[model samples]
Every structure is written in C-alpha cells, then in structure tokens.
Target: MARVIFLLVAVVSVFQALAAPLHSRAVTSPQCSQFNVYASAAIDEARLSLGSINTGNDIGNARNILQAQLSLLDANTGVTEIADSLLTSAPPAPANASATVVAGLQAALASLNQIFFLADNTTKAAVAAANASMITALDNAQQAVAANCQTTLN
Candidate 1:
C-alpha cells in the first residue's frame, strides 16, 4: 500500500509539472531602444545638411529643428521607462507618466506584433511597410522642423 501511494503522488507531480505556464520575456524601450536609434539618425542627417549651408539664418533654424526633434525623442524615452516597469511587474493601471507612455507604446507594439502573428506570409511584409510608414512620418516631421528653424535663424 505504501509503495502504491508513493507512485500515485509521483504521477501527479509529473502531471503538474507539465501544466506549468510558459512566459516570454521581451525588452523593448520606446526611447533608447530601436526608437531612439532611428530618431537620432534623422536628426544627425538634418544637422549635417544644415551645417553645409552658407547662411547663418539657415544654420540657426536647423539647430532649432534638431532641438525640437530631441525633445520629441526625450518624451518617447520617458514613455519607455514606464513601459519597462509594466513589462517586468504586474499591470499598474494607475501608473505615472512612464506607465502611461508604456501603455501607449505597448498598444502600438501589439499592433505591430499582430502583423507578425497573421497566418499569411504577407504579414511580415505588411509589418515592414507599417514600420516604414512610421519612419517616413518622423522624417517628414523632422524636415519641417529643420526648415522652420532655418527660417527663424535667417
């Protein structure tokens, strides 16, 4: 009877082990991660272009635009910090600014992720297209800032 009881307990433990949940860890920051990378690149490119100009006015405006770009990137970074916390911890609906940004970014990331989960192989291409759209938007915004800044400097 003792041996039979021990075998039953072992079987139950094995079954329980198989029932354990699996968790996937992801570490993506809206600021210092992939986001900052692209933003910074755009800024650098704009700044470099401004520097090649002959007029002081144009240079000044370009600088202002770059500054504005940096500000936007900073805001995104703030959001990332909030998101990082939520990812590692339980969902805090009452999160502060960081949390709020994280939630927003999380939503965006989810949208991007869904493109990957779609059954069609076209999903990845679609995701890439979406990403390109975002990059293009940023680029256009940056260009406007640079142009306006240059005008102000002039």
Candidate 2:
C-alpha cells in the first residue's frame, strides 16, 4: 500500500509539472512592434528635415530644423529605454533589443555630432564625411530593426 501511494503521488507531480504555465511571449511583442513603427517614422521625419537644411540660405530656418531633428532623436532615445526594459524582461525568448537600439542610437548621435561640427565650420571635406557617416548611421538603424526587432510594425 505504501509503495502504491508513492507511485500515485509521483504520477500526479509529473502531470502537474507538464501542465505548468510557460513564460508569455506575446505580452511584450506588441511593444516591440509599436517601437519599431515609431522609431522608423521619427527617423524618416528627421531625415526629411535634414534634407531641407541644405537647400536654403536661411541660417535661422536651418537651426530650427536641426533643433527639431534633435528633439525627435531625444524622443527616440526615450522610446528606446522603454523598449529595452520591455524586451529584456520578456520571457520565453527575449531578443537583444537593447543592444540594437544602443548601437543605432550611438551611430546616429555620432553622425549628428559630426554634422554639427561640419556645419559650424562649413568645410566641404568635413561636410562630405558627415554626410557619409549619416548615411551609414541610417543604414545601421534599419539593419538593427530588421535583425533584432521580430514583431512587424503595423
């Protein structure tokens, strides 16, 4: 009777273990989707503003545009922080969203810094370098999202 009871208990325990809940993966996937959409939109708008900067001789207008781009970048940085927290804590299968965001942001900020220096000096070579850096940064951002962010941004 004692052996039979022990076997019964063991079977029940195994059944319970098999029925245990897994880490929820769907919970944070939406956040990732929203983040991808918002970040892409923000980057696109900033690029548009930056594109306009070279066409005009108005220093004041250019400064305003640059300030807008900076503001957008700042907002993106905040979103990135939120995304990092959400993605890292997500269970089942968490992607390295934080690393991707950090890399993209670092590259973008470096490009922006270089551009600011070039703008102040108005040197052709420096401007060319800044433009190339900006292009690379934008590409990095795209690749990061494509590689790290799994959710489709709708």
Candidate 3:
C-alpha cells in the first residue's frame, strides 16, 4: 500500500509538470517594436548616405545626412526626438525596457558611432576601413532586432 501511494504521488507530480506552460521567449514590449522601426529607418538612411560618401558624390551633404540619422539612435538626445522621425506616433521607450530591446538599441548605437567615425574621414583607405566596421556594426544591430522584434513590430 505504501509503494502504491508513492507511485501515485510521483505520477501526479509528473502530470502537473507536463501541464505547466512553457516560457520559451520573453514577451516583447510595444516600445521595443517602436524602437525597432525607428532603428531600421535610421540604419537605412545611414547606409544610403555612406554609399554616397564612398562614391565621392556630395561628401558634405552625405555627412550631414549621416549625422542626422545617427542622432535618431542616440538616447542621450531624448526619446521624443527619436519618436518624431516616425511617420506614426509612438511613445518613448520605457525605463524598464527588456534586455533584448536594450541590446538591440545598444547595437544600433554602436553602428551610429561607427558611422560618425566614418563621416570624419574622406581618404580611400580610411573610409574603406571605417565602412567595413560600420557594416559589421549595422549587421549586428539588424540581427539583434530580427531575433526578437521582427514578429512583434507594428
């Protein structure tokens, strides 16, 4: 009777465990989705400006555009400025943003920094090196966003 009761308790515990919900992924926040959209636009703009700079076509204009794009990803400038660039209205990123969201934004900011470095140099070799670094940073940012924000963005 003692052995039978022990086996029954074990079966009940296993059934309870099987019935529990799995939390495979974190629930992405709305702020993350907004930031993802804004970051994508900013990165696209920077890429276009970088290409123009690389081709030696209106370097000054390209630099200005690149700077403007970089500002959008800069958190120190204020979230309102970043949200203003969006065609649709979005609330500022929450202070308690998820780790995934913060990681994505940090990656974008690193790319922005790389672009800023690229903007200051016009030499072929310097520009080539900066461009390579900028591309890698941008790729990392994009991958970060795709990992969590793709399915959740508006």
Best by lDDT: 2
Q: Whole-model lDDT for model 3 versus the true structure? A: 0.44
Query: What residue pairs clash in candidate 3, if any at all?
Result: none
Candidate 2 local lDDT, 74-123, one digit each (tens): 54564455455445543322355434544555545454554333344333
How high is the lDDT of residue 130 in model 1? 40
Compared with the true structure, what per-residue lDDT tens digits does model 3 show for residues 1-154?
A: 9999999999999999999975432234565455545545544444454444443544544554355345434422332333332323343334322233344445444444444333344533434543454454445445444554332223
TM-score of each: 0.28, 0.34, 0.30
- Residue 62 displacement (Å), model 3: 22
Per-residue lDDT over 103-142 for candidate 1, one digit per residue giving the tens place of the 0 to 100 score: 3333433334433233333433433444444354355334
Best-performing candidate as measured by TM-score: 2
Candidate with more favorable, higher lDDT: 1 or 2: 2
Prediction 2 TM-score vs. true: 0.34
